[model samples]
Target: MTRDIRQAAAKANSPEYMSLWAGQGLRLANDQPAASTVKQTIDEASIFVQRFLTMRNS
Candidate 1:
């Protein structure tokens, strides 16, 4: 998921998505000994999916 974020960030220049990934990355960076990074990535991806759906619907 982190890789996905990196890939998306690398391919696109969306500040909102970038910020979301950055925030998730920061949270992951801060958590120690816990597998929170994956969860964070999942949450971030879910947000992206929802945004995409909203845009499509609109």
Candidate 2:
């Protein structure tokens, strides 16, 4: 479903992204995380989640 964005943004007004979202009115924000940071965060979260699940199931 295509809808209008009341506020203005670069991508919203850029002709390069005219084909973006296929007119779905959905915007993909640029969020490129650092590889090392992402990996470290994921590792930390995975360990916490594993421990929590194990404790809960005990």
Candidate 3:
């Protein structure tokens, strides 16, 4: 098992190889425009941080 893992990791190091990985959130946003997705994520993150910080202080 470790040998197989090492082989996979070695293949990933090749410059010609590339991985197009995306999280569930990114996959869900695929239909939206890129700019819109970015803005929405940032806005949501800002709101979450604000709420979390306020809660921590209370």
Q: What is the C-alpha lDDT of each candidate?
A: 0.72, 0.64, 0.74
Model 3 accuracy (lDDT, Cα)? 0.74
Give a tens-digit lDDT track for model 3, residues 1-58: 4566556766887433344456677655557798997999899999999999999999
Question: Which residue pairs come into collision in candidate 2?
Answer: none
lDDT of 2 by residue, 1-58 (tens): 2233323334477554233454543364246668976887899999999999999999
Candidate 3 or 1, higher TM-score: 3
**Poorest 10 consecutive residues of model 2 by lDDT?**
1-10
In order of appearance, the predictions have TM-scores of 0.44, 0.43, 0.55
Candidate 2 stretches with Cα past 4 Å from truth are 1-6, 10-33
- Candidate ranking under TM-score, highest first, comes to 3, 1, 2
State which candidate, 1 or 3, has the greater lDDT: 3
lDDT of 1 by residue, 26-57 (tens): 65466445567677788999999999999999
Off by over 4 Å in 3: 1-17, 23-27
Best by TM-score: 3
Backbone clash numbers for all candidates listed: 0, 0, 0
TM-score of model 2 (CA atoms): 0.43
> How many clashes show up in model 2?
0
Ranking by lDDT: 3, 1, 2
